[model samples]
Structure formats: C-alpha cells, structure tokens
Target chain A: MSAFAALVRRDLVLAARIGGGGYLSLLFFMVVVALVPFALGPDLNLLSRIGPAILWLAAVMATLIGLDRLFQADEEDGSLDVMLGASLPLELAILAKVLAHWLTTGLPLALCVPLFGLLVALPAEAMAPTALTLLIGTPGLTAIGAVGAALTATMRRGGLILAVIVAPLMVPSLIFGVSAANAAMGGTVPFTTPLAILGAISLVALVTAALAGAAALRGGE
Target chain B: MTATGLAASFWNLANPTRFLALSGRVLPWLAGLAALVTAAGLYMAFFTAPPDYQQGDTVRIMFVHVPSAWLALFLYAMMSLSALGTLVWRHPLADVSQKAAAPIGAAFTLLCLITGALWGKPMWGTYWVWDARLTSVFVLFLIYCGILALWRSIDDPGRAARAVAILTLVGFVNIPIVKFSVDWWNTLHQPASVFRLDGPAIHPTILVPLLVMAVGLSLVAIALHLSGMRTEILNRRVRTLTILQADHPSEGGI
Candidate 1:
C-alpha cells in the first residue's frame, strides 16, 4: 500500500514539476469548449443545447491524449520493472495509477467543465449533473486507457493505434455521459440513471484493464 | 453434399494446403452460387414478392438491407468466435479466419448502411438520422474498422493478434445494441416484427427469398473466408521462412 502511495506521490510530484496531465487536459477541454461557441455564431440556445456534449466529448479526447503517457514511460524506463520486482501487487499498483490518472486528468476536467458550462450558457441546474457525469465517467476512461496503454506500450505508432482500439470501447461511457447531461438539460429524467450507468462502466473498465493488463504482461514476458 | 457434410469438409480443409486446393476448385462454384442466388432473390423480390401497400418498392429494399445487416452481425460473431479460438485454443487457422473476415464484414456493413440510407432517403426524406438502430450499426462498423486498424498497425504478429482479439471481444457489445436498439428507443426505424413476439410479419414470397439470399451469402462468406485464411497462412509461412533465412545466412546469401 505504501509502495502504491509512493508511486502515486512520485508521479504527482513529477507532474507538478512539469505541469501534470490535469492541466494539459483541462487546457484542451477549455480550449475546445471555448471555441465551440465562437464557431456556432454565439447563439446561446444552440450552445446551451450542445454544450454538455462538447464538454464531455472534449474531455474524453483530452483525457485520452494523456493516456499514452500513462504506463509507457515507466515501462520503458524500467520503473515498471522495479515495481514488479517489489512486494506490491501490480493490480494495486495499477489501481493507484488509475486513481492518479483520474486525479490528474479527470479531476481537473471535472472542475473546469462547470466554468465552460457558463461559457456555453448552460443553465445553472445543468452544471452539477454535467460535472457529476464527468467525475463518474473519467475514471472509466483512465481505467480503459490503462489497458490500451499497456497493450500498446511496445508497439510503434501506439497513440493512433490506442485511440482506434480504445475509442470504440469508450462508447458506453460516451452514451451514458451524453445521456446524463441531456437528461439534466431536458429537466425530465433524473440525472442519477446515467450517473449510475457511468459508474457501471467505470467498474467494468477497471476489471477489464486488470485482466487485460495481466495478459499484456504475460505477453510481454 | 449435405450441409453437414459440406460443413465437415470445410473444417477438414482447415489445413491451408487443403483449403487452398479446395477453394481453388470451389471458388467458381461459390461465385456462381452467389450470382444465382442474388439474381433469383432479386427476381423473386421484384416480380414475385407482393408489394406492400404501406412501403411499396421501398419495402423491396428490405430484401437487400436486412440480409446485409444480418450478414454484418453474423460475420462479426463468427470473427469474434474465431478470435477466441485463436487466443484460447490456438487454432492454426483461427486468427487468419478472424483477420480475413473483418474487411468482408466491413464491406457487408457498408452495403447494409448504404442500402439503408438509400431506402431511408425516399421514405424518411433524409440521407441519415441518429436513430438507435442506425447508430448501433454504425458503431458496429466502427468496431470492425477498429479491429482492422489494430490488426494492421502492430508489427509484431503475436502482439497484433492479442490486441485485435481483445478489441474484438470488447466490441461485441455492439451486437446486443444492434439487436435491441429499436426496442430500447423510439426511433424513425420501425419496431421489430420479423424477429419478435408474433414472429415474421412478412409474406412467404419475401421470406423465402430472403432466407435463400441469407444462406447464400453466408456460404459465399465462408468460402471467401477459407480462401483468405489459406492466403494468410501461406503469407505467414513465407514471412517466417524469410526471417529464418535472414537470421542464419544460407550458403547462397541471396
């Protein structure tokens, strides 16, 4: 547990020194969100209707861009080998990494989305669900991205390959994320339904990454 | 040969040598079968199948559209199964079978989507809509392309297989979505009558030919798959031998 915590702290420290995954993804997310209103001719109704979707989609893409750096750098530098050599279970190590990932990427994205919600003129009531949806959803992105990153760590041109492979799997998260936001905007269905589905996706992604990551390690060995 | 016998023989021809030989002999027959079945199905569809008062000629598009859709699903199912076989059982031909089936599946999916759009344009007065059924099938196509891209991108053969296999397994989620999308959401697409509570709403004329073409396409797809697996095996063998020759210099280096 200490090892996992230490690894997370180390990663966080490194990120803090060099501007972590969170800042970059948040920057990308805000940039994309900010641009959409301008491109759409500053129509508040149009922006309001589509803002949640743009935020969610951009969050997904930005979170994913940082994912390529998740495991590959450590594995390449033999930091992963040292961890494997240590007493900590790889699964726990992975879980910690995923949490770090969400903390670094997902958390900031979640925090920044509400600000963009205003930029797009989304109703005040819609902000909470949109933020909540992103919070529940980005963990799944990091988890699934872990699997893709691990699998492609040794491959050339891995980023594009990772996106191609992982994006389809992201469909469930995308569906639930968009739905939750739309429901919030529509004022009919409770936002809990899609939030629960998003949680389900995160759990599924966690299990899949652990299993697939194990297989990937075996394949690597 | 009976269907069982043909199926057994195809399995036996799973060996690349036998597969190549058999497909070489049988390609012409399978080609003829596809042509005959499609021509006959088209004829039956136009002249013999009674037009619906509601859908009219647009209903005829279902003849091509539905089968293509079914083929898309069927091919992906088979491909994923083959992927499992490759990963678990290490079937000599299984990976090749899965790899070969992807592009063909994508093509069939493209056909289904195009035909659906053609039918929709006149009926719905639009080229496309994000209806549930349509969206799900569209996702299916994306999955197919994704599998293909993963298979091609990785240079390492074993790693590529695992990558594609894992993705294929994950992408199977689209199947249920495609199947139940209409039920899950109220869309411009009609509710299921052909595969549901009441069972088969269409008349016999339409049903029979649709079945025929469906069977015919599956057979042709299998034949094509067998031929493709044979080519892949040969290609792998050539690659392996070349790598071996490169690693240890032969007496004649060339």
Candidate 2:
C-alpha cells in the first residue's frame, strides 16, 4: 500500500518538476476548440449544436497525445525493470501508473474543458456536464491508454500505434461523454446513464490493464 | 464405437504441426467446398432469392453483405479467443492463429462496409448513415486494421504476439458495445432481429440461405486459416534454419 502511494507520489513529484504532460494536452485541446468557431463561422447556434462533440473530440485527442508517455519514460530509464524486480505486484504498479497518468493528463484536461466549452460557444448549462463527463471519462482514458502504453513500450513509433490500438476502445467513452454533454444541452433525462456507463468502462479498463499490462511487462523482461 | 471415437479425436489435433499436416491434406477439399458453397449460395442469393418487397433487386447485395458482416464479427471473436489462449495457456499455435486471422478479419470487415454502402446507395439513398450499427461496425474495422498493422509492423514475433494480445483483448470491449449500441442510443440503424429476445424477424426463406452462407464462410475461414498456419510454420522453420546456418557457417562443409 505504501509502495503504491510512494509510486504515485514519486510520479506526482516528477510530473511537478517536469511541468507534467498537462500543458501540452491542454494546448492541443484549446487549439482544436479555438479552430472550431472559425471553421463554422460566427453562427452561435451552429457552434452550440456541435459544441459538445468538439469538446469531447478535443479531450480524446488531448488524452491520447500524452498517453504514449505513460510508460515510456519508466521503460527507458530502466526503473520499470527494477520495479518489476520488486516483490510488489505488477497489477498494482499498473494501477499506480494509470492513476498518476490520470492526475497529470486526464484531470487537468477535465479542468480545462469548460474553458474550451466557452470558446466553442457552449451554452452555460452544458458546462457542468461537459466538465463532469470529462471527469468521469478521463479515468477510463488513463486506464485503457496504459494497456497501449505497456504493449508498445518498446516501439520507437509507439504514438501512432498507440492511437490506432486505443482509439477504437475510446469510442464508448467518447460516445458517453458527448452524449452526457448533449443531454445536458437539451436538459433531457439526466446525464446519469452515460456517466454510469463511463464509470463501468473505467472499472473494466482498470482490471483489463492490470492483467494484460502485467503479462506484457513480464514478457518484455 | 472405437472408429467413431477415433473420428472425434481429430478435433483434439490442435497443435500447429498436426493442424498444418492435416490442413495440408484437407486444404484442397476445404477450398473446393468454399468455392462450391459460395458459388451455389451466390446463385441462390442473386437468382433464386426473391427481391425484398421493400428493397428490390438492390437486395441482392444482402447475399454478400450479410455473409461478410457475419464473418467480420465472427473473425474478431475468434481472434479474441486465440488471443486469450495465447495469453493464458501460452498455446504456440494460438499466436499463429491470431496473426493469420487479423488480415482475413480486416478483409471481411472491408467487404462488409463496401457491400453495406452499395446496398445503402439504392435503398437508403446514401452510402453512409452514421447509424449505431454502421458506426460501431466501422469502429470494429478500425480495430481489426490496427491489430493487423501491429502484428505486421513489429519485427519480433513473440513481442508482436504479446503486444497484439493486449490490444485484441482491450479492443474486445467494442464487441458488446457494438451489439447493444442501437438499444442504448437513438440511432437510425434497426435494432437486433436475428438473436433478439423476440426471435429472428426474417422469414425462413431468407434465414435458411443466410445460415448456409454463414456456415460456408466459417468453413472458408477455417480453410484459409489452416493454409495460413501451414505457411507460418514453414516460415518459422526456415527462420530457424537460417539462424542455425548463421551460427555454424563452417558446418556447411564449404
């Protein structure tokens, strides 16, 4: 338990010192949202209709941009080897790494989504759902992305490969996230269904990553 | 009773060597079966199967469309199981099966998409609908291509297998999502009919042929897979011999 915490703490400290991967993801997200208004003209209604989708799309891309780095840094420095050598379970190590990744990339992206929402001409009511969806869905991004990160840890061109592998799985999360935002837009039956499904996806991703990543890591050694 | 038992034992020949040997002998037969069955099925599909009251001659596309679609989902499911077998049991042949199945699966998926579009053009007046089923299948295609690309791009076979195993398992999430997307979302695609709680919606006339084509395609896939496994095993042997030659250059008596 303490080891897990220490791993997370160490990762956080490292993220802090290196300025994290947050800013880069946010820059990508913001730039995408910023471009949407120009592409659609000044038509507020048009922008609002696609506002949630644009936000969700930007969030997914942003999360992916940082995902390849989730395990690459550890794999490169040989710390992953030492960690594997430790008595601690690889599953726990994977969970810890995913958590740290979520904190650095997912969490911050969720935080910055509302600002992107505004740039895309989102209605005020949609902001809460937009942010909320990101909050719930981002954990799934981190969890599933870890599997890709682990699998492609040794590949030099892992980023593109990671996207190809992970993007399809990201569909459900993207669907629900945007659906929740769209639901919030129309004030329909609360965003509970999508939120719940998104949470389930994250749980499943967590378990799957733990098992698959452990096997992958062992094989890598 | 003993002969019957001996016949059933054939199913247990799951090793690559045995499978390759058996397939080597049976490949011609299976290929013949595939060609004959598909040819008969297509004839019935285009000429015998009456045009749908609603869809007209364009319904002919259903012959290819339905079969390819079935193969797409079926192939992925098979790949996932092979992936599981490889990961859990370290079944050597399972990796070969997965590597072989990917491109075939992707091809089926491509055929499904194309035939679907061709069908859609006259019936729905659009080649693409963004409907729940269509979109999910599209995503499935992407996943299939991704796995195939991953398998091909990685140089080391063992590493490639391990990497693709994780990928295939993760991507399996799309299967259930694709199955239920229509119920979950308000999309243009029709909901499930064949395997639904209410039973298959289509009449027996269409259903029987669909079933035959489905079986035929499965047989073809099996045949293709067997031949592919044979080639893969030979490739592995050639690789090993080359490595041995590299290690003992003087042993060749030059």
Name the top DockQ candidate: 2
Runs off by more than 4 Å, candidate 1: A86-89, B1-28, B251-254
Best by lDDT: 2
- The sequence of per-residue lDDT tens digits that candidate 2 reaches over residues B81-102 is 9998788877778888888888
lDDT (Cα, tens digit) per residue for candidate 1, span A1-221: 48889989888877777785758777888888877877889888888888888888888788778787777788788888897887887887778888887888888888877688889888898898898898889889888888888777776457887887788778889988999989987767788888898899899888878777756655554
- The local distance difference test score of model 1 is 0.82
User: What tens-digit string does per-residue lDDT give for candidate 2 at A1-221?
Assistant: 58899899888888778875757667788888888777879898899898889888887888888788778788889999888877779999999988887888888878876677777788888888888888988888778778888888877778998898888878878887888778877766577877888888778878988988888777765
Clashing pairs in 2: none
**Model 2 TM:** 0.92
Which residue runs of candidate 2 sit more than 4 Å off their true CA positions?
A: B1-15, B182-187, B192-200
